[model samples]
Target: MSASIAARNIAGVVLLGLGLAVGSTGAPAVAATTVHTGVATQLGPCPTPTEAPGTEPIPFPLTSSVKPTDTSTSTVIVPDGPQMQCSTTAPTLYEDITYSSPTTGGVETDLKLDLQIPDTPGDKPLVIYITGGGFITADKSANLGQRTYVADQGYAVASIEYRTQLTGATYEDGLADVKSAVRYLRAHADEYGIDASQVAVWGQSAGGYLAAMAGATNGIKRFDIGENLNQSSSVQAVVDEFGASDLAGMADDYDAATQTAYMAPGSFINNYVFGPGSTRTVATDARANRAANPATYLRRGVSAPVVMLHGDQDQIVSPSQTLTYLNALKAKGVEGTRYVVQGANHGDMSFLGDPDAGLLWSTQKVMDVITGFLDQKIGS
Candidate 1:
């Protein structure tokens, strides 16, 4: 197809993704495919349960895995449900905290945090995880089990939620939510018994993108328009797993599946960083958007260390993107790490759902890197 026709097709895909960025709107119901084993389907109230006349019955136990209860804080009670247990050990501390940011019209985004501590008695490290949905679909609840696993490893884990561009939300707005989240954690580090100086950021897919951006430029300078424009919420380390590092990179033509995913309803990578039309300037200086890209952000400074994770078979975010991103980091002489899950798909827990590929890296592996990186940078 002609470049113009291709761009128009991509636009159609992006628009579709904007619609599906948020989770199901109406009341929860069973689906043909269950989420996992422990997670529950969060349903809102809807008038009618839509189903086709010839459709099969929706399956029961529709969630993936349930999250363990948060009983560390007397004030915080773990919501009752089936939860996945990552490790044999249980966490010793827990806290349920919420903070509001005026970044996006004073809208208060919520965060579900679990603070895990080690028995040895040294400085505690922190890792804030942003779940992936290309900046639109994921919520804190979807990752409770994974956060608990990381917490059991003895690092404070904060599962963050940010505003996405799916519904026309701006990158400035989403970054503001993230910046606000960092500030909130830093401002109340004592409450969670954490050493604010040892904080790190990690995320999967879109979350990885957010983690990179938050750590890339650092502070309000990352997002052009936020109220405390000079505030800084820098982290000690960063972990980006199959995240989109370059917006302009996405404008290139992709296969149907990748194109669909790149343009899915909740995905706003293009809109958030590159603005509306493919030709629109995403930032004040068109270069600013590129400058905001993680690849371009590598420079001489005490910026957070980085670790990138991706699957070679990922049709979503191309492998070339990760290589290019890593190349930029290497040219700068910055210390970074990478792990290519040999045959896995983009962010899918398994290698095309295979068990014998021997390259099936789970969220736990990602957590290990985060923990290891924090230990090296800040010490456990």
Candidate 2:
């Protein structure tokens, strides 16, 4: 049989195999699907930030993401193959880090961050990075190679993790975790050994979504926390790599099989973060979920500079998703810097070849854009 026919046959079996009957091919098939299922379990919820208007800037106790009681469960996953290690010989710098948040009840989560500070750090600024895996998988360790490469360019780098495994099933919950993480970094400025005011955010996939939302919604009236944390969490720049920006819009465009994966277990973002009763619907549990969408949040104002990178042939998150967001930003006079990695698929490791080519091409340019923004904002 042909590839399309083989796909159809396999799809039919998978659906029927999962207790779903094969629908008739007589009528036209629509991409939009209605999911009737129970909850998708993943990480627990992150605490909410309370607005504290007219109150003095409280010196909140800080928390570091690293914990003494915690144990290392797994080493970094080398992208090319099994034997290749990510970051061993690369130089590493240390910084005393801590953050405090009302969500954690003012008790800091013992955060000990390792900085990959370059030799020439006076002019170079930092990019506070968060890695992505549907907001459940991956961590600071897995990004060792990427961090090491970016650090070689004279930029100070910090890899961070917030209350991980969040109920990212909704925008409100996911963004709340992001907000708290940024606030934590700001709260412990002196400890991290960098100017907190000059920080820019960057991430891959879902992390990209969080970074985009942080910059897009910064200082907005809707998502503000009435505390000093609110002011500190604001980002001066952002770099988003093929993340889903518009939840409702993306859901409306998702292919059948991807939607199936989404409706399945362990697909945290789709299963728990969105779906039936979430904010994507008007009659869902709370308005905060739908309002959590970054696409809906984009508007004219003091918008921060942004650099977006995506693979033109990305099968997971469509290119249209990035285009829609970039268009919206440009319409508002934001004019974000963009580069579509030609023929590249989502998260492919091919771009990392040719070490002599340097870090100004491919996705590495993302870190460069961030470094330039920080130079303009902080180093100036």
Candidate 3:
């Protein structure tokens, strides 16, 4: 079946399910699953600057500074596979590193992330990976091998879990989680021997949306939430793969008639932007929709360099999303690169290789492109 047809069928079924759910419960129900079982760490304030802003700089003699010692280790278990070729060595994996952030209700939620550090480490650059599931379901385990492969390449890789629509979380909540995770990692960079200034954020599908938001609003105050407020959540680079850059525009383009259908409230696209149980039109809330869009944050001096990968045949997020975002970046004089994978559908592994070769081959090919891009932008 063609990807577009498959996506439309899936959308119909999902809308039907949502309708039934609303009918039975009279409201959107939050999933009962508990996100975390432990108390979250409390981060302290940022250190005061030595000198006042706009003050004349003090002159000091240039001297050699000793680099911090490397004493960190990884615990990731490596399986023998073709993907192993991406990394020459195994990385130490630290699972379930928890960080706390507040939801719209101001209630604390414990967010978890998995960190994979290269066994052979200096002050390595870091990359935070966000998984794609249309903002409804996904976890740190979604792309374990790819993450480990990156870690093995002399970088620290972190896979994070953010609240989803099922948890009654909106796009804003998810974006906040991404920023908070960056802050948490920076706050403890010394413990892991990470070069905090060289951090990059990468994500796929829904995760890509969050990654784009993080990159565009690198220093924006509104998205900065949770602990470690003193720490800058700004990332130096971003890799967005098949993610939506503009929520309102994409929704209107995807299925304008269905987007306003009574059952469309249950659709993933609507729920992600408007929150669960929403009945308002996506275009109705222009300000909220614009705030959620990464394009809104793109400006001449405020955005980070971005590399975007999208499938021309993507059924969920159309290629126009990337084109529109790239155009905006260009207009603002922001640096960015876009690669449209031919004959590929939404999240299709075939874009990486021949369909007959299987996922392992395709994954390795994709990894090469990603690593090469990282090497140029942030230095792998």
Q: Highest lDDT, which number?
A: 3
Q: What TM-score against the true fold does each predicted structure earn?
A: 0.65, 0.60, 0.74
Residues 1-380 of candidate 3 have per-residue lDDT tens digits of: 44433433333322111000001112112122333222222332111223221211111111111111111211111111333344444566677677654555555566777787776647889899987765776466655556666766778888888887777888887888888888888888888789988889989878888899999988888887677788888888888877888766653334444434422445566777777777754566778768778888887766888888765545456556777788778888988877765444555332222232223223455566678777777774
Model 2 stretches with alpha carbons more than 4 Å out: 1-91, 95-114, 121-124, 164-170, 221-231, 251-254, 260-267, 272-290, 348-380
For residue 20, model 1's alpha carbon misses the true position, in angstroms, by 17
Q: Candidate 2: lDDT of 367? A: 43
Error of 2 at 69 (Å): 47
Clashes of each: 20, 17, 4
lDDT of 1 by residue, 123-146 (tens): 467778776655555454434445
User: Model 3: runs farther than 4 Å from truth?
Assistant: 1-11, 14-84, 104-107, 251-263, 348-364
Deviation of model 3 at 59, angstroms: 64
Ranked by TM-score, the better of candidates 1 and 2 is 1
Ranking by lDDT: 3, 1, 2
* Most accurate candidate by TM-score: 3
lDDT of each: 0.51, 0.47, 0.63
Q: Residue 239, candidate 2: how far off, in angstroms? A: 0.3
Worst 10 residues of 2 by lDDT: 13-22
